[model samples]
Target: MAMLNQVSSQDVETLYFNHHGWLLGWLRRKLDNSFDAADLAHDTFVRVLRKRELEALREPRAYLCAIARDLAVSHWRRQALEQAWLETLATLPEPIVPSLEQRALILETLEQIALILDALPMRVRQIFLLSQIDGLTYPQIAAQLGVSINVVQKAMVRALMQCYKVLYRGG
Candidate 1:
């Protein structure tokens, strides 16, 4: 067990030292921004270090590349969502006015919440969103959906589970 642990620790350290520059270069090629690439490279190493077992990795380079790719995709998706949200907010009426910074912050929070909601089942997502965002009480939501209060509670629990999965699993 000691030998295995030492080998794994050495392997991870060597992997990081040998490939850190290459990983940053790869990210730069994909992202076209040195600062963003650096940030992604740092995040990738953080993720690898947090994993439980590095010795079991058959292809460390491939795993790290996948992590970087996922991060890049998430960054792109967030940017797209933010742009769309800004455009939507720009057209809103004066009654719901929000400042530019507030609009950005709200969009970011909404994006995160929406990602959590996306993991939920359709009905559960709708029910939870109605309760939290629409200000509908459990009993009111139950009545509107023609379900019992118990059913509404179960749906809320299910929705919360999905949110936890997304947040904790980093999905």
Candidate 2:
């Protein structure tokens, strides 16, 4: 279908000219911050450009809105995660608190892990988190979740394989 076909640079240029203002305003209303709204609007267009498929888009505004919505959700999720991390840091003694650079590195790593966890299947993710984050054994997880040990083991394997693919295999 033409909708799935590659879009040309000129088509993207036309799209930007046609809808940029509307998107910016829509983002502003959703984000309540002009700067972030502007940034996300630009990012939404960039994402669309990367997809490179818009020639047969029946509803460009709807398509843009969907992309922008996803971006906004991610933006909010990141902000919430940062706030939670900062709160955790605040609970630490000053001497034990990490340096700014170390905190940045830690936060980045945490975000990556969070993304991987988010991508995992629900049951697999629960098992993986129980084992890794809560320090539970497979048997313990199985007991807690009312599942078989074999089930827990298999879920753990799937979760680990997914993480390996995302981190090491760069999938």
Candidate 3:
């Protein structure tokens, strides 16, 4: 068992040595950020190691690229969400605006909520945002979205369940 573990470790080292530079370069070009590319390259191997199936990866580079691409997409989505959130904050009433320290805390919480919402379907995401953030009624949401109230209700339920799961995942 110990010998097997050592061999497995050696295989991962070999894989990293062979592909890390090429993967980093590719990701750097794609992301246009050396730091993020390096982090993603590291994360790709970390995921492989976490899976404990390095030996099973026949197309290693392809596997790495796929993971890297998904991570890149996730990063971009988070960036977009942050930009939208900041724009929304900028338009808030001065009286209701949070203090600087409170704003930081709120932004962090909003980022968590964004990640929770990220897993939702596109329509579900839209409906949930409309109802929760814009204070839309079910009928209003349905009309705006061109769907029945029942469909809007179902989407709200699903979106809320996902948010619930994310919020209570540790519990």
In order of appearance, the predictions have TM-scores of 0.59, 0.90, 0.77
- Candidate 2 C-alpha lDDT tens digits along 1-171: 554667788878988999999999999999999999999999988998787455687888998999999899888878888999999999999899999999899888887888888898899999999999999988899999999999999999999999999999986
Task: Candidate 1: list runs displaced more than 4 Å.
Answer: 1-11, 93-95, 99-101, 117-171
What stretches of model 3 exceed 4 Å from their correct place? Answer: 1-7, 53-55, 80-104
lDDT of 3 by residue, 26-136 (tens): 999999999989998899888767764434556879978998898888788767777886798889998977788987787678778767777899999999999999999
Residue 27 in model 1: lDDT: 97
- Expressed as tens digits, the lDDT of each residue in 1-171 for candidate 1 is 312243355666888898899999999999999999999999998877777655556666787899999888877878888888878877989889788789778877877886787668888998998998999999999999999999999999998887777778876
In angstroms, the error of model 3 at 123 is 1.4
Worst 10 residues of 2 by lDDT: 1-10
Best by lDDT: 2
* Candidate 1 clashes between residue pairs 3 or more apart in a chain or in different chains: none
lDDT of 2: 0.90
lDDT of each: 0.83, 0.90, 0.84
